[model samples]
Target: MTREARQEALERHGLVESGDGFTVTLKGFQKAAERARGLRAQGNQEAALMLALEPSDPVRWEYARCLQIDTFSTEAYESGF
Candidate 1:
């Protein structure tokens, strides 16, 4: 299908949002990344974008993998996690 068709289809029926105020937010960044990868593998760009909880793909730098990230997150810390 063409890009426009995909976009229109998603606009009518999407995965994350039901065209309502509701939106999906996946727990755990890594897990959400995996889900996005799977969605892209299955279909067109617009569909994948609409379906994936996050519109953007996850980026993990090679250097990041080597480090043990223990930085304090205000969101996580504030939640008493």
Candidate 2:
């Protein structure tokens, strides 16, 4: 990033103190913790959803299929691609 952009980000967020080697402020650490917590919550939700689905369910089946995971496999593949 350009120097101007970096300076702007630092000033706008107030997440770090402009000092010897750039120390992280409490707000910065809190933000990081919040992000980590959110990610963990999302992972747990995904795991619970996966576990709740029957093994024979289309979603479970699709989870193991690369084409299904990456794209519109069922209709698109049948339509010839």
The residue pairs in collision within model 2 are none
lDDT of 2 by residue, 1-81 (tens): 455655555443333434544443444433433443454577855535544566556554333232222222233345454
Q: For residues 36-80, could you state the per-residue lDDT of candidate 1 as single tens digits?
A: 466568875743554433335333321111111211122234545
Q: Which regions in candidate 2 have their CA more than 4 angstroms from the true location?
A: 11-22, 44-81
List clash counts for every candidate, in order: 0, 0
Candidate number achieving the greatest TM-score relative to the actual structure: 2
Provide the TM-score for each candidate, comma-separated: 0.25, 0.36
Candidate 2, 50: how far from true, in Å?
25
